[model samples]
Target chain A: MSRLSDLGEFGLIAHLEKILPGGVSKEWSVAIGDDCAVRRSSGGRSEFLTQDLLFEGVHFLPGNSKHWETVGWKALAVNLSDIAAMGGEPVGAVIGLGLPKRAKLREVEALYRGLARAARRFSCPVVGGDTNRSRGGWTLAVTVLGETRRRPLLRSGARPGDSLWVTGELGGASLAWRAERKGKKIPAAMRRRLLLPTPRLEWGGHLAAFGEVGAAIDLSDGLAGDLGHVARASRVGFDVDLETLPRPRGFAGLCERVGVDALEAMLEGGEDYELLFTLRAGAEKAFGDYARSRGLKVARIGRARRGSGIRWFENGREIPRRFGGYRHF
Target chain B: MSRLSDLGEFGLIAHLEKILPGGVSKEWSVAIGDDCAVRRSSGGRSEFLTQDLLFEGVHFLPGNSKHWETVGWKALAVNLSDIAAMGGEPVGAVIGLGLPKRAKLREVEALYRGLARAARRFSCPVVGGDTNRSRGGWTLAVTVLGETRRRPLLRSGARPGDSLWVTGELGGASLAWRAERKGKKIPAAMRRRLLLPTPRLEWGGHLAAFGEVGAAIDLSDGLAGDLGHVARASRVGFDVDLETLPRPRGFAGLCERVGVDALEAMLEGGEDYELLFTLRAGAEKAFGDYARSRGLKVARIGRARRGSGIRWFENGREIPRRFGGYRHF
Candidate 1:
């Protein structure tokens, strides 16, 4: 078992810096070690910024977050997913953690390691942040800044004729979480899926270049809920085919026992962190080819129409729920 | 008493978005309802980011920050201070709030108002963030994104003989917090100074352009603690002349009554959030000129020496202290 005493906070930060890519230079401008990282956005590109906070018990249960490193990776991954949904490139992030004193230093250091790994992978630096001891539960918050070369993918851009596409499998996380919560046996692959989520970075750039990907939002909050957000914003309705959701291996049968539609799990069970986006109707083949060449899963889950809300199809009949999606508030 | 109910959460968001100089739209490249904002970067500009988490009982007592609006304003102010110290041009921010259920709707609206007011004042937008009900007191965690043009003011850049400069008066916050705690009537001016700190945004730009603001840091955890970070990072020592330290209004009298070093308040008191930077010789004139033009206080509190550690002065002699500086951990 590793301990924070093995690598002090400075050592931890050094580890992170060492792992990150070498794009930083004095001229690139960073003001660190004080309170903030001072930067000069003299570059011609537009800047994108967003922040997300995860509080224990509120955002994730203890076992759901698993290890501190997983929490850190998930933090950066979730933020990166946001950027990816907008077809933005990750640059830097500031992390603020309100850690309960009960947390171990080893866990904190491991958490940094996970963050550093993701930052290195994404070429974003851990510029500057604040840490404090909290009397409450552990809280992790990160604000990420990114840039894009062209127009961003917005949920409001989806039109009635657009076809929705999702990257990778969904419902795996919900299955994994439920299994883990019940202390049931989960396959190692499913366990991994539940932990580290790959933010669709490469596909994000492609989607942006294609100009066919209309409105897009990430599936941090499952499909139904996030789609509801898109629908509410765009004032359009969607009809989802229940059979189209890509469930993780071993969970297909469980969906039947749960007495709920698997599509509902795909729509409402969150933590998938995939890009759920709509593209121009005619661009489906192009997207399919793009996904096939990328060795990715691009599913045709639904279609946008000139209507009001979302509806799921089961046995050629419409199944509706009172609530459209999960409410985190 | 204006209530948050007057501006519900969605209403508050709309209000903030509406008040921005250029409200969120396609112009944002990426705006609300998406995961993150994506913009293009400036030439040679790296993204600079910082997060400021304002705790109700910890960072602020029940007096000043007890009101949600002031809490929001101060939270944004602290983050802005971080951005300013880095000499980063402010772009935008995200507010991650942990609000108690007991907090009134008006208070929440006022909080958003304060948030919008500061965002517009700093020319930064409040892009996207997370808010949740808290079991404890309010926690306003604000993360800001900024950029620099050329050289970044880093803590590692200070050399021996560099003149250490402070941007403005400190210790008003301590007095304010104490006043509010004691329920004493503080002057309206003092109260304003304490409750709302104006970050030195313009001064930061001057420091970066001057080409001799060797190393800089924001004084958030008081002067001694924050400057100690710079000194340690640069591997240099510092000697502060007591006479050169700037004192706030009525500070001298207050120090006399307390029977303590007035300079220590400037040194160890927390939440000043002013810029404390070291300048190479010959750059002082330009820096001083800019500060004066900006109607700000400039203090040559110390100078970097060859050795490490810091020393304080009483008239002409070195002074000793019981403990080192303000403790954040």
Candidate 2:
């Protein structure tokens, strides 16, 4: 007799995990709980499968062509991030789009064009889909299929003494949200970071190729929450050095001007779509060299340790905190 | 500048086909414009992928636990039918579900249970999925992955001399719709057929094993409209013998009471989920014997010929027709 609101998002997932049959099969190595389900394919490769859903009002604002296009990009980008988290290469995607009766064909086409553009960028084709008329707002459900020749990265591989690293800057999504809420126009760079996140596919694939990186996750649910998932799955904890964390240009000033806490925004902001992975201790120098060689910026922001939850420190002083990032419900 | 309503569902699909890259690859034998996208997997087998979407208030009524359960079942069932249409055995499925905030936990559990039941019945596991909260009604998008050792069937395989056959009676879905529209109580049998259709998986697999069946399509868009797809794809026409079509018990009487044309209902009502396939000339007797051994009911309802579109006849006399079946937009 309980309502969905009471269970929250993670609770609901846990409930489903209990009720449904074991998500794994003979060919599948990982299933429901992972970022992407992994299935053993031929040629020493494993396939990754992930799905994501975005609703009109819930996920995006219904507007002109640009808005629809951005929605389309995000719908596929999020699922691609799942594959990236698994250190997989793109194969293809299927989009299930639901449009209201009054939807314009041009807008719908623009959406498809946006999806096609992203597919081409990642070398993944739009293979097939289903389109239907809806009695509600527009819904875009995208499922991406990917493959990896190397062993797939997983959240459960993190261990105590592993160095935590992240790609790109954080807090861009939160800064954009705060700017919009305060009636301030978002900066062009920040807006792009917020709305058009580039999945770190190459970086993730490189991590897998290195064979020394312990575990990885995408920063979709903010650093604290997502790292918490890695911590729980790997039965470890994290100690983040606040000062070492990379920030978007003018991040602190923008947060202060918008009347938000800069450090909190960086730690708890969601949808950054950056890679948060752990490398074995002493492997940092070599990994940093590799990152620089690839022209990718990576920062060692924290370290995994023997504990239960994330512990934060600013200049070696423990900072007591609360705020577990975004929850959909 | 056209609205979606102007182009309709098929028109939108045609538009997408032109704008996107050729939905094919070195490993993919078929992609867009087929029951399932076929990818050459390992072990001399090819994989089939298909997706389907169902929206609340458009495809079903949102009510109590039973209604949610039925919706979940139909969501996966329709995708299975697509795999069945390709004459493939399902390997697994992924579901994307969007629920309104008010959706009950108990009901969602019931829905998942129903999905699990169907998955067990067909031996297709629910391997993965994404669930999100929506700003609108419930939405279910399901993608099924299947595989076949035999060559997958295609609509373009129909030849001029093929015999058209259908498994199960027609008009049940149309009758259910009519009865509901007229505020009349729908008979239990008709309602079950409409909502909980049994995909003709065994029959489709058998046809593919026979290696002589030409084209095949699931009866989701009614016989006439779906047959039109095969006709266009194979460059062959059809002459349907209306008298030979098997009707649900009391179909005509129910249609008459609801003020609907029985013939139109039988030819144009959608969601039957029956197998409509073409067989090579003079193979009916052998196929019939196989069907009898398997306890499957099938009837020869038409003949493929060298023409352009479907021509309907009643008792060898042409019956002029206008209805072209269901279009979502």
Candidate 3:
């Protein structure tokens, strides 16, 4: 709890190093002891960079019974998904934190513990950062450095004949939030599904090297919303087969409990943290085979069309998108 | 005016791009159109990096007349000082802003304009950024990147015999802040001193190439406070000659209006953004010559000692540090 200036630049940094579970690796040629950090990419590997900001209240409410560690985990997980979307492996991350002066020392430490856990899990270093006192709420800004060997997958270049696919079913996070709010005693298995998301990085990297995917995106904003992004970015439309859409097991009953259609969940409920990608029509079999070998479920949901806009088909009936996904503005 | 999510990612980004002034140059490799921005770095040239955060209430008051542009400039200025300490030239910067949802659009746009002006003046690009809604107060976090060819300076390199020196005068910001509060008008030149901080980046960079300075720091946290940082970091003590400290021509008169000690103001008031450094005793003449030629006044304010702790001497009489400095927490 020392004042930033009083601790002095060096003392402040040393204090931060002590709090970290383990130190950054030797890849950091110029680390915390210097004016700035310096690290060379693993001998000519291209650098992959992405940043995310988590503002208190907007990202998470302080009163939520959900633990801070989980918040830390999901924050990093979501950004990692962005790198995964690029078919890259995470190397390290720098965190910039703004906390109100009144914030508890214990809470701050816990937040870093969560950050450290995520770093260790992803095998990325919690490299360097800035910790400042805020006038109001806490804010976390993270910039991740990732590495790619083959090539980076971008959101452009989807062909009209390419097939679009998604990994895992969506809507679990929305349902989890509701359940948490209602204090529903859901089973540990489903609760974990809602809380801890799996980043499809490994699958995406292999898909990139396999030369099968033309464009890729992560389902951070649900299928309908993020698919729209890829389609727009690629200047193509999509025709999704409703019947082909994957559903969560026992999803129908869960939809009934919520008084809504299960299709809505699959299309628009976000925080899935799953990868959505497009592949050449002829590459589906091999792609599917590779995914299954990795124990991941690949759902062929739609096809890229020459036109703009998305349409859904089910049992010979075509339907329009009732809901796309969440928006922040 | 737009629910951020409603704006959608592309639409929101376009809005930002349109509102922000066009880039001064092509330093940004990927710019705003990609999944992540790519930049020129040390692989090309040694890069300087620093991130700073300013929270509402702590840094500024609600309904304060200070425009968002000032806040934006201040954020960039503070980080610029860090790079300046390392004697690096500004290249580009990224701003991650979090605002209370209720903030006006004009305020946000002004913030960008302020950022744009700073970028143009410093010859740094507004490469990229992240924006989100804060649960409560508005927060502005800026990460600045700079470049240098010389060995980066650090706070731990000062030797016991090194003479301590400071560029320009200190404590002008505290005087300006006090003047603004008392409803007293300061002269336009003095006002500019408070509103626009002069970053000694080029000066520091030149100093670094000369390679005579032992250790260095920027005076963003007032002189005593920031000097204390260097003292502790170097594990050495310093004695400051207060009589040699340059006084802003207009500052001595403010003691009466603000009911504060001018000396104390010079000691603890911050945001001067001046470089404070230590150099080997024999290099004093060269340092003085260089400083004089550049129209920059340099003074031999102290000496680094074998032990730790900072002491101030006025008329060669040792004086106690009445106050440390302004600290956020």
Candidate 4:
């Protein structure tokens, strides 16, 4: 008889994983507790199924039409990140919209306009949806179907001694959030990154095609939290060198000006939408070659080890664990 | 510049259909404005995708744990009915859940238990989903994927002079709704029908296999309003004999006791989840034979005509058109 607030986000998911059935059935390769569920029908390629819900006021404000458009882009982009985490290309998407009675018709249209923009960019068709009147703020749920010929990446694939790496940089979204809360001006680049994240679909596809990449996850839960997922799934521990972690330009300076701890932001901030993955031992050179050839900037920041949870280190000194990432509950 | 309240539900959908792109694409046979979006991929059978959103207060009240469980069942069942409307078998489903901060852990678990029950009943696997915190009431969005080897039924397939038919009795849900609104005790059977509807998956599959059913739609929006959808989509009209409409046992008596118009409830009350379809000319007998063999109770109620809108009649007298069905807005 506990409240959901006590269980928190991951706790609720854990409960669902136990109560729900049909994990890896005959037609499914994977089910719950992953970036996307993998279904493999006979004579057909494996498909990925993922869904994300965004609530107004919780996820975004019911602002102007322009802001609503960006919210729409972000709603679909987050689900696309899940597809990218699985190294699959999106096939189609269906959206479920719950709008309050007072919402404007133009705002709904603008939301779709943003959704259409992302769909076109990712080559995923907006297939169908259901709309209903809500007693609350706006609710947008997008479910994307993805397909892949290669073996889709999973968080359980990482082994001890694997090198941990991340694409692009971290802490931008978190920084923007902290700055906005403190009534400080957010950096324009960080604000854009927060509003409209570019899913690393190409990089994920390349990693899957390389065939030697280990566990992978999108950085929606920041480095410390996402690595914990990989660690638990892969039964391995991570030793991250905080100094080697990639950060957005002037991220530390901006955090200092806003009186927010940059290290805490980089480790626990959510919604970065960057890919964090591991490479098998001795495949680093080959992986680096492929990444460079594709003009992808990736940084090796840590190594998986024979332990549990994440052990953060800075300049060979162990840092005490503090942040627990972002949780909705 | 108008509000969504002004345009209403269907009007917003029509606006979206025009604004959104990639309808009937190379890999998609149907997109929007149908029971489900049909996807025809190479080397794979056609797949249907649909989504539905249910909000607390709008769709249901957040009562006890048992009520939450029924809410979960209805959320998935409605999506299953969409697949049933298309004559397709559900492959898998992904749900997006938005829970208020004060929601209970047991309530969420109970909700999943109900979802598990419906998923097991239909053999549609609940694969993956996203859970988020809401600033308002609970929001459940479900997207189901369905597969069909036979040609899926469409609302636009009915021709002039085709016989319209419906599976099972109607007005049970609508009657219960009226009873609840009037603070009257509803019949147990009617209450159950409103809470947990059985999607006619097998009957729909049979209709698709028969390949002679003209058009199909699930009676979610009541008899008269759903007919309007088929009429507009197929570019035909309907002539329904109100006397021939099937009703639950004591439906009229209950409506009369509750001070509700029986005819209006039968025509415009929603959430029936029954299959409303048309039989091709000369296929009625064969269809009846199949339905009888399957222990299905079906009745012929009307005919599609070469005109616009619906014309109701009883015993050679035309009834005035009044009810427009249940609308959220």
On TM-score, the leading prediction is 4
Give candidate 2's iRMS in Å, 1 decimal: 1.2
Q: Give the better candidate number (2 or 3) by lDDT.
A: 2
If ranked by TM-score, best first, what sequence of candidates would result? Answer: 4, 2, 1, 3
- Candidate 4 docking band: medium
List interface RMSDs for the candidates, in order.
17.9, 1.2, 18.2, 1.3
- Residues B1-329 of candidate 2 have per-residue lDDT tens digits of 67677788988898877767667988777878888888887778888888887788888887788877777777788889988888999888888889997788888898898788788778888878888898889888898888898999998889999999998899898888778778888689998887777887887887788877999999998888999999998999999999999998777778888888888788888888998899999898888888798887889999999988999888999977765968888
Task: For residue A27, give model 1's deviation from the true position in Å.
Answer: 23
lDDT per residue (tens digit) for residues A1-329 in model 4: 67777778888887887777765698888888789999985465789999988888878888888988898888889999999998999989998888886788888888998988888888888888988888999888899999998888998999999999999998899898888888999878998899889998988898889899899999998888888999999999999999998998887778899998888888888789999999999999988889999888899999999989888899999988666877787
Q: Where is the poorest 10-residue window by lDDT in model 3 chain A? A: A29-38
Ranking by lDDT: 4, 2, 3, 1
TM-score of each: 0.82, 0.96, 0.81, 0.97
Task: List the DockQ of the predictions in order.
Answer: 0.14, 0.71, 0.13, 0.76
Chain A TM-score for each of the predictions: 0.81, 0.97, 0.83, 0.97
What lDDT does each candidate get? Answer: 0.68, 0.85, 0.68, 0.88
Which residue pairs overlap in candidate 3's backbone? Answer: A135-B58, A327-B5, A328-B3, A328-B4, A328-B5, A329-B2, A329-B3, A329-B4, A329-B5, B42-B45
lDDT of 3 at A178: 63
Order the candidates by DockQ, highest first.
Answer: 4, 2, 1, 3
Q: What TM-score does prediction 1 earn?
A: 0.82
Q: Which ten residues in a row have the lowest lDDT in candidate 2 chain B?
A: B14-23
DockQ of 2: 0.71
